[model samples]
Target: MREPAKSKAARTIEVINRLAKAYPEAQCELNFANPLELLIATILSARCTDRQVNVVTARLFKKYRSPDDYAQSDPSDLELDLKSLGLYRNKAKSIQSCCRRLIELHGGQVPRTAAELMQLGGVGRKTANVVLGNAFNINDGIAVDTHVARLAGRLGLSAHKLPEKIEADLKKLVPQEKWTLFSHWLIWHGRRRCYARHPDCLHCEVNDLCPSAFRFD
Candidate 1:
């Protein structure tokens, strides 16, 4: 039997369809109740896990409620709050500047667009994608974190060195409507199967669709 000679778009749709069914509960694991919380969480998530960030923010949020509050926060106190995450110094400065910019330009509210979020000091494409997707409910771009990048390569969806390049490739193949879900689904699959150290392809829900699937005969 000949395999389907479908285009990249077709495979993308197929992958999304199968995985969406498998990961119906896929969503951001970051603990946030508002846009400001999400922005701070995404920033703290740099080189950190959602679990760790959540533990820290459980207290951090209480101290800093609004952008202006963060803008006026003392770096020493903020650093102490984030020391466990490592790189606290830079993150502290970034959050301070990020919140300052938010107050100065955005009227103390988190911007809804990726471009607007990018104007903040600490926010990049990945952070912008997270804020836009989770906080503002906008699917303007895919959130290409380490999980998304590794899974995309393992699944043969994107072949690129940089996350931005991989994001562009996936965006071209995936429909806009599925971009948000695609990111969440890939994160679920990554956390479950395509792990950073070892991928348990044998137990993967979309093992057949994933190129890394185990095929023992």
Candidate 2:
């Protein structure tokens, strides 16, 4: 049976509290110093791990210090620099095109709004939310990454399969102030405890609160 909205909201708060305790230091694992660097790193992170993205960005950030740097660079050279990532060619093109858009439209600055950010190449609602919440501290919306999406369903928070729908469901339950931190908490839990294949429900802090707990065992 579907849970009542009132009870579900209460459970959601408890889940967030438990997750907060479990992952007190959880935050965006993607390494970046500023909004622009974050924007570039986020674009490079498509289908790529944060650790790998960070490894590449350590050098890439040094080379391309600004949108103009990426916009003006040779496409071949840029692709070569990002060749280690999953979709290097496509990501390179997207990054260059995105940077050009930034230069031309936003004055070479990462836009603070999700709508503006989404208009850029290789960017969608998820990427835009990530940038807005993490880079600009603007809680326009939650970022429903794979981890967040999986955890949401497993926790009985949302039945929706699409990220937008899941995010919409979460936004209703989670408080406005903790929007960004809520994503971090769920992501950390998904990574460390509620893994895709073999979630450690036995030791999971929120196992009692999770309706799907031990179902995979």
Candidate 3:
């Protein structure tokens, strides 16, 4: 008699369960008090760490509390305020443009659906997914950042290189209720353990279940 082959869904569930236990307190690290704030934060998070985004938003959020503020803001002034973050000029433009659309289309509130949110300037699928999942508690799709994409391939959860394809692969394996938390867990783990280089697999919590575990060792 041979051992049974583990189904992809079963393997994913086991991985999720272990990760949930390992990171019981895992959540979105980006600080935001509202959907609009989260939307802005996510846009600024491109090529920037959550810590860096939070630092800039601390003052930025205080200065611009509403979509109207951003819509009314001077582009040069906004760029100056966001100078600390790389690509400040483009990000500032997107923020202002997105806010303008919010004011003109949605009355200055972040849209709840992914489709509506994506229509805003600078709000791509990844950013829209982040706002939808973390801010609105709507699991429209998994937020596939660099970390998620890397972990998905390493853990054999997804072979797709593109975030959208990876997100689709993950959505099929992980349960809908766990979609939001699943992304969070992978992100937290990627930052802490399964790093892009020099992963510390010696103490990885899910090493036993991870097919790519210790490949670097």
Candidate 4:
């Protein structure tokens, strides 16, 4: 039998409820002391793991203190600092350009709103949402990463291809207060059980709640 497409609210609530129950201690995995640090760390986190980001940021933070530090550094040198992560060239350029914008317009502070942050180089919806939820304490929206996107489909929560569309669907299901935690929980579950290659459905805390779970068979 064909399954019905879930409404946005239904999907959001399911993702939120299951993920929240699965990972009760879900929080931002990235380590940062302030909003500026979180913003910079989030930039470095593109296409990289949080552990890798933390390793990179440990040294990068010591070398660069503020937006001016990033803005003033030579791009080539900054790229070398991030060489271990690879894709350093583009990431370095983005960090410099984005920091320059922060200095020139926002007076060295990370912008809170997604629209404003998106104006900065490499600041997409995910990055903007991370800053909003973590740095600003406004959990208005979920930041749909690979984990959230994949789990949303596997759990029959969302069928959307685009992260933005999936995020829209999730937004409708989850209340605003739970958005950030819900996103974090899914990320935790992905890392802990539902890996890209294969999911450890048996180890999953909310496997019973998951539509994709095959244990019933």
How many clashing pairs per prediction, in order? 0, 0, 0, 2
| Pairs in steric clash, model 2 | none
Give the poorly placed runs of model 3, Cα more than 4 Å off: 1-5
Candidate-wise lDDT, in order: 0.87, 0.92, 0.92, 0.85
Tens-digit lDDT string for candidate 2 (51-88): 89999999998999999999999999999999999799
Instruction: Report clash pairs, candidate 4.
Output: 9-173, 13-173
Range of the 10 consecutive residues with the lowest summed lDDT in candidate 4: 6-15
Native-to-model Cα distance after best TM-score fit, residue 155 in candidate 3, in Å: 0.2
Candidate 3 per-residue C-alpha lDDT over 1-217 given as tens digits, one digit per residue, 9 for 90 to 100: 9878678789899999999999999999999999888999999999989999999999999999999899898999999999999999999999989999998899887889989998999999999989989998898899999999999999999888999999999999999988899999999999999999988899999887788999996
Name model 1 segments beyond 4 Å from true. Answer: 4-6, 215-217
Q: What is the TM-score of each candidate against the true structure?
A: 0.94, 0.95, 0.97, 0.91
* C-alpha lDDT (0 to 100) for residue 183 of candidate 4: 84
Instruction: Give every collision pair in model 1.
Output: none
* Model 3 TM-score (2 dp): 0.97
- What is the descending lDDT order? 3, 2, 1, 4
Which 10-residue window of candidate 3 scores lowest in summed lDDT? 2-11
- State the TM-score for model 1: 0.94
Query: Model 4, which residues run further than 4 Å from truth?
Result: 1-15, 215-217
Best by TM-score: 3
Cα lDDT over the full model 4:
0.85
C-alpha root-mean-square deviation, each candidate? 1.9, 2.4, 1.2, 3.1
